[model samples]
Target: MSFQRAQHLESINNNLLDIKGKIDVSFEFFPPNSEEMETTLWNSIERLTPLNPKFVSVTYGAGSGTRDRTHDVIKRIQKDTNLSTAAHLTCIDASKEELIQVAKDYWEHDVRHIVALRGDLPDNSAKPHMYASDLVTLLKSVADFDISVAAYPEVHPDARNAQADLINLKRKIDAGANRAITQFFFDVDSYLRFRDRCAAAGIEADIIPGILPVTNFNTLKRFAGLTNVHVPNWIHDSFQGLDNDPTTRNMVGASIAMDMVKVLSKEGVTDFHFYTLNRSELSYAICHMLGVRPTV
Candidate 1:
């Protein structure tokens, strides 16, 4: 190999070695809607449990059916695994009183961590009763729960501007959130700049980077569009002409995620959150590449 290529390989190796045992990761899973999906979710959890994630979070939906599933999954994980579990709570259709009761139930059942969010409105015309900061405040009133709130590196879709979005995040932190787990982004520089902005704004809470290992390019584009996350052209180029190939897609996805973590680690980012999309193979491979191994 050329000297330049050899040096690049050595640098990658050093980065991997540097981050071993220094990174803390968390995984996010959505509540499964069907029996088969539930089985798949459990299997993913079982496969990842050995890696010893800092915590696992279950996503809450806007409707009651999904709410119940989220709670059930959280409870089951708490009971079945030794890992810390966090429940996602949102202020969408529920009233303050109802949300308080839900918080109370979680606390009574020994679930102390919560990921609070301002869920999507049913329509543009509907106004939300409470935002994520409001939910954080309400959850804190019920108990001294460890709260996690969402952050957007690209900026929230509904925000008037990026500064407004940052202010909203600060409100959540001020209200009682312990940390902010960012929305998944492909651009590492966007996240680093956002982190700098947060520090300059006097927000001292840990802003953990959320890493989504892309399994399908089509699905990723759709999600990115909805969330107003920018999909860099390079990413588009990487997945070009690979739509029909699942195995190649998985390899590319893992390589992209691994490179992201290595760069983030060099910047002193020790914590990461993975949006598993209820599948573990890509996430598992990424974590393994980062030197996060199963204890047992």
Candidate 2:
């Protein structure tokens, strides 16, 4: 999906009026652990706000460790900026009523968007649950809030297969999910195929491809291993032996991500959600290459 190979790039750009040259963009942020980190996250938000993202989200930590902090960060974003804020909520480590109250809190606080999930359990937590008291039950309980559920493009590490994962996605949408956000993938083909499968399964929602700018290839590879997201050999080759040079590694990272986004733009995708990993340079660079610019 090279830029030159795309015949519809011009027409698509003209037709998708909401896209800013490339289209709508959103960002993902995790809650801070201290005052210094808080200042940093806010600075990051301020930097990206000028881009006028469709919305910005705060991530919920595994097993709900950051629940209060996540809410604080999100409410702060909504209060301090013009950006629409979405707070992530997970079903693990809580009961149904607890989940309901969280949803209502967002509603009362003038926050209408939610990124809902059944987050993974702690490592020592021998047998984690699916929040399966009923996945449908939980999603419906939160339905009054516009929620975006997680979609595993490579299929969830734990899911039986790609098709089985789609079936679970269908269940969530049927239970009133408004959208889905996929785990980040290096291959556009993985996302494209996932999109087609979602369509065939009768699940309709904005299935936004999540992009991760390689902050630390070693760190990212470790995380991908934990979640079962594969790092293709070719992608590894792009960054091999560059661990010693942070500057060069970042440049290579930005270029590779830009290359992927350019192809996706050609495939008629206009919306993107970036996993900032609490740093802005790589994501900012990649976005610039895709025609996203901060206002003067």
Candidate 3:
């Protein structure tokens, strides 16, 4: 091989080898709707548990049925695994009395952590009776639950402006959240800048970066559009013309995630949260690349 080709290969290898020290990781999973999906969810959890995540969180949905599913899954994970588990609680359609009961039930079951969110409201629906900050306060009243709230690096779609969004996050933190897990973004620099802004605003909470490994570009574009997350033109070009090629798409997606982790870790980010989407392969591979491995 040419000397330049050898140097190029070594450079790529060194980039992965350059990440120093230990990295902490957490994962997010959504509740399953069917027996088959539940099986898949458990299988994914089983696969990732050995990596020893700091915590695993289950996402909640809008209605009673979905809420029940989230509760059931949280209880099962707490019962079955030695891992720390968190349940997602939203203040969207539920009354304060109902939410209080849910909090009490979770605390009674030894579930001590919650991801408090003001869930998405439907069009034409009345204004939410409670926001995430109110939920944080309410949860604290019931128990000293370890709470995690969402942060938007790119401002939340519904926010009046960036400063207003930052203030809202501070309110949640001031109301008693432990840390903030950001919405996933591909641009590492955006997160770094947001972190700087958080510090300037007197917010001292840990701002954990959320990493979503993309397998479906079209689906991601739609989600990004709704959430106001910017998809760079380069990402679009990378996934172009690969709709028929799942294997290659997976490879490209994994490569992108691995690179993002490397950059963020170098920038003093020790904690990462993976949105597993109920599949473990991509997250497992990325964690392995970061030297997060199972212990004997």
Pick the TM-score winner: 1
Clashing pairs in 2: 19-23
RMSD of each: 1.0, 4.4, 1.3
Once fitted onto the true fold, the runs of candidate 2 whose alpha carbons sit more than 4 angstroms away are: 1-20, 62-65, 123-143
Q: How accurate locally, in lDDT, is each candidate?
A: 0.95, 0.79, 0.93
- Encode model 2's per-residue lDDT on 152-231: one tens digit a residue: 88988778787778888888887777889889898789899999988988877889888888857899899899877889
Native-to-model Cα distance after best TM-score fit, residue 256 in candidate 2, in Å: 1.3
Candidate 3 TM-score, C-alpha based: 0.96
lDDT of 1 at 155: 97
Q: Model 1, residue 147: what's the lDDT?
A: 99
Q: Weakest 10 consecutive residues, lDDT, candidate 1?
A: 287-296
TM-scores for all candidates?
Answer: 0.98, 0.87, 0.96
Candidate 3, clashing residue pairs?
none
Alpha-carbon deviation at 87 in model 1, angstroms: 0.2
Model 3 residue 114 lDDT score: 97
Better of 1 and 3 by TM-score: 1
> In model 1, what lDDT does residue 174 have?
98
Angstrom error of the Cα, residue 117, model 1: value is 0.7
User: Per lDDT, what order, best first?
Assistant: 1, 3, 2
